[model samples]
Target: MKNSIFFTALLATTISLASCHNSNAKPVISNEIASIEKTSVDGNTKIQVALLLDTSNSMDGLIEQAKSRLWNIVNTLTTLKYNGKTPDIEISLYEYGNDGLSAEANYIRQVTPLTTDLDLISEKLFTLRTNGGSEYCGAVIQDATKQLSWGKDNDNMKLIYVCGNEAFNQGGINYKEAISDALKNDIYVNTIFCGNQQDGINSYWKDGADYGKGKYFNIDSNRAIHYIVTPYDVQITTCNERINNTYINYGSHGYEKKQKQAEQDRNAGSVSSANYAERTVSKSKAAYKNDSWDLVDKMKDDEKAIDKLKKEELPEELKNKSKEEIKVFVAKKSKEREAIQKEISELAKKRQDYIDTEAKKTKTQDDLGNAISTSIVSLAKVKGYSVEK
Candidate 1:
């Protein structure tokens, strides 16, 4: 039973890619209202997860595992529904214990705010690098708790996952106080200790979770991730290509964002065939929205979006086209994307079944991905969220 649970969590987070240099620290919440407003009215709920990772000298393996398993975790989140309504999902990221960060900031940096831009998340996650530094678990947790725009809705699943190998109470900020504040804001803090279970317990990692009313997991941060290639993987990749052709870039950064989508695809593919397929499956889900760049996704929210776009902002292919022509083009592509997504969705189900079967035969291995996602699924169930089996 335990192995099955671990395998499921591994499946949830096991697809990630790409990297860039770290950005300057911005403590402010990027888009609080905008993020909440993006939530579908029917559901009016959100799944907000904040990842606090220790990027110290010894955590190269931990970062690699996170990069490899991003999409799997995203796919897992998409399966959850509250009151039978699909909830909007947002993830925030934080890096702590890096010498590259400002010491005045307690060696902690908020990499990204809670937002629906999964591509941005992927891009930023890749930028993280390990450096020898202090690991202030309490300080990082406190920043994530106070800074991110967490929803007050009782239905929202607001969770903070802090992963590291250091002592949980090493920081100046009292972990107990930080956890108390998080609970007051209705956020559950889960801890992932990247070492022996007893070591973690002795170091107060378990205590951190207990105080915040969340799960505590111990994992081997350096474990190699195993991927199972499914028969449907090829079909999913083909579907992904078809779907990419359906997006029409518009706005100032449209073309750049479009290129990023493809770049991320390449990054995922570079990891492994299974990771590539996992990303394709994530793209097929409703949560993989790209309204900020893709015309087809934009038109869903704003019918007059074409009229609002300046010609200079339009992609080269659409620059010469009239509003009516563009509208027709977008509409056509939207339908094509819908059809392709449906096909991928169907194939993804079969692919997952294949993986589940294969996973049952192998001994489960613990890693950062499994430790984090296992708790996500369990907590989702407790919070009245149902997985779409």
Candidate 2:
């Protein structure tokens, strides 16, 4: 499901895999199109988040926090009630550092395009490694604005969060110009400086946030992340395993995607059982839809999905079955997945309650998760979004 150069593992999906390319090159495409199709069909607008993380040597801690807390952040988005319904979420990732990037381009890589596949996002976060390299705030921001489709309409809350620990005004590209580009497209460029607030201000990080009309946060990247293990964790993990059983693989990438799903599940478990449980809870949510690959998700997205796919394009398992049979099979799986998801959702609420109570006893510390959570809720409220009870 994920990292290098921690170690190398090949992946087919390009949602957020790591690689460096110039902004002038063709832009990478991911799940945005499918999301657009879904939106057009359902009239469900999306909240887009472009997360630009610096992967230079000293910022390893930030990557770790991202890996652990991404599912929690996904769950956070699910709570948003905008104009009487929750908006769809699409997240993109960019990693900038001289370690595995173009030095001439200021060490910037558009790691992933905007995607709704949360598993892919988790996969890419775990793959990141820190190396000794330069961080250019301006160049990376410009790359995102030029390469990403920020959408034409301003109805969606389009945002960019760039986290780094270096001077904001580094390299040839002027940060003022970069922030100006973001503002032009109505993209909020929030800066998360991985150090002291004063140091961030001194480096002009706050100025960048001001230019884009976004929140500015400074985090202690070295702080260890803490999770409260609740009695509901084991139940949630079991529910997660059961949920996986309901996925009906019926396309070329179906089997691979199914395996990758389990692999990411293991990846989360390897980090912490609590992280795994949190991810399981996320998988149960509405945002975990992966219609691009899985038949159940595809059918859910469009009722005519079976008719749309040619018989040759169907997976080997589905080839022998009648169209009617395949439809019935997918429908059964969808129902099963729904039941398991409901159970996980119920358990997750209890888990959150337990954690929320335990949270009162701990001291607050600056970290990637907290910074994003604080900023996302704050900005969403200002934009007419509500957190549903």
Candidate 3:
């Protein structure tokens, strides 16, 4: 009986071991598994851009170029897909120069609000005409600070490109305040200085741009005009075609033809007599000297209207509504009223801010220009280069 019991225990242990081995064995199926999974990062990100343009009389051609090249810019941006997707972009435009004394009409208009529709932006650009007093860096910065809807999303990149021929820092608010505000909001401000001479103003603009975490481009007005008329790609392609056909066509002389054509294309549609005449007429028609003062008066009137609205009695219909209905109605009405009030307030503030920030400043145009140039030179030195004065 003992031997039989021992044999039974050994048999049970063997079966248990076999069961564990079978469970641990790998599967041997002939089936195939396919995965259709695609990896992608979550959330839609966007680039917010504010175009601060100099609308002074001198920037007429620049404005025209910007308007014409806007579509090309948009197309280029579209080609630069981020994370295998096109990024959403919002563009806003502000022109300086309508205000007199660098203060009153500094910011002429917010032509296009921050928006994703590129067509709308294009339309706004077409409508923009240069007719302003001067460029006020501080006023533009302050206006942007108060008006622009920035810092709404962490992933969104905010950029401001201020293009002008005038010196920066001639306005009321100093460079420090503008730079600080821009950095605080993570907004990069690029200064594109379009001028004939290299002066100290360029350096100041570059310094402000650096402080705002942005880039600077010094564009010669003459060269810029040529670029606007002749697209870069056209020039490259034409040159290449000429080089390839040099042996077969005009031999060595064919090269001269190509060079001539390129030069002609580059010099095409420059500021001619007719162009200047048209621009002069446009300027005369769009002069804001009289209209600006009228706008100031209108702003005052709007303020008084807002004050009256605040003090006026509530409408009977709204006053006698049920508690829930009143709550909903009041909410809607409040939002609408707030929007109007905010718009008016911004308009008023924009005017006053320009005046206060630019008009009252003691800095001369040349002084500001020199300061900017020095700043750029210092930056260049730090970056291991010698900047000639």
lDDT of 3 by residue, 244-337 (tens): 2211112223334335433422232243322221221111111101111121212222433222222113333434555456445544543443
Query: What tens-digit string does per-residue lDDT give for candidate 2 at 33-147?
Result: 3342332223466788999998887777898889878888888888887778767788888888646555655667666677777777787787776766878888888888877
Q: Candidate 1's residue-wise lDDT over 1-389, tens digit each?
A: 00111101111121111111112333433353234234333346999999998888788788888888899899989999998988988888888887766677787777767878887778767767777788888888888887777888999999999999999998688899889989999999999999999999999999999999999999888888888888998989988888899988887768888998998998888878888998999998888998878889889989998888899999898899999999999999999888888899889999989988998999866777777778889999999999895
Q: Sort by lDDT, best first.
A: 1, 2, 3
Give residue 210's lDDT in candidate 2 (0 to 100): 89
In each prediction, how many residue pairs overlap at the backbone (N, C-alpha, C within less than 3 A)?
9, 2, 14
Model 3: lDDT to the true structure:
0.44
Score residue 112 of candidate 2 by CA lDDT.
62
> Quick one: how many clashes does candidate 3 have?
14
Worst 10 residues of 2 by lDDT: 1-10
* Alpha-carbon local distance difference test for all models: 0.82, 0.79, 0.44
Candidate 2 wrong stretches, greater than 4 Å: 1-43, 310-312, 315-317
TM-score of each: 0.90, 0.89, 0.46
Ranking of all candidate structures by their TM-score, best first? 1, 2, 3
What lDDT does model 1 reach? 0.82
Better of 1 and 3 by lDDT: 1
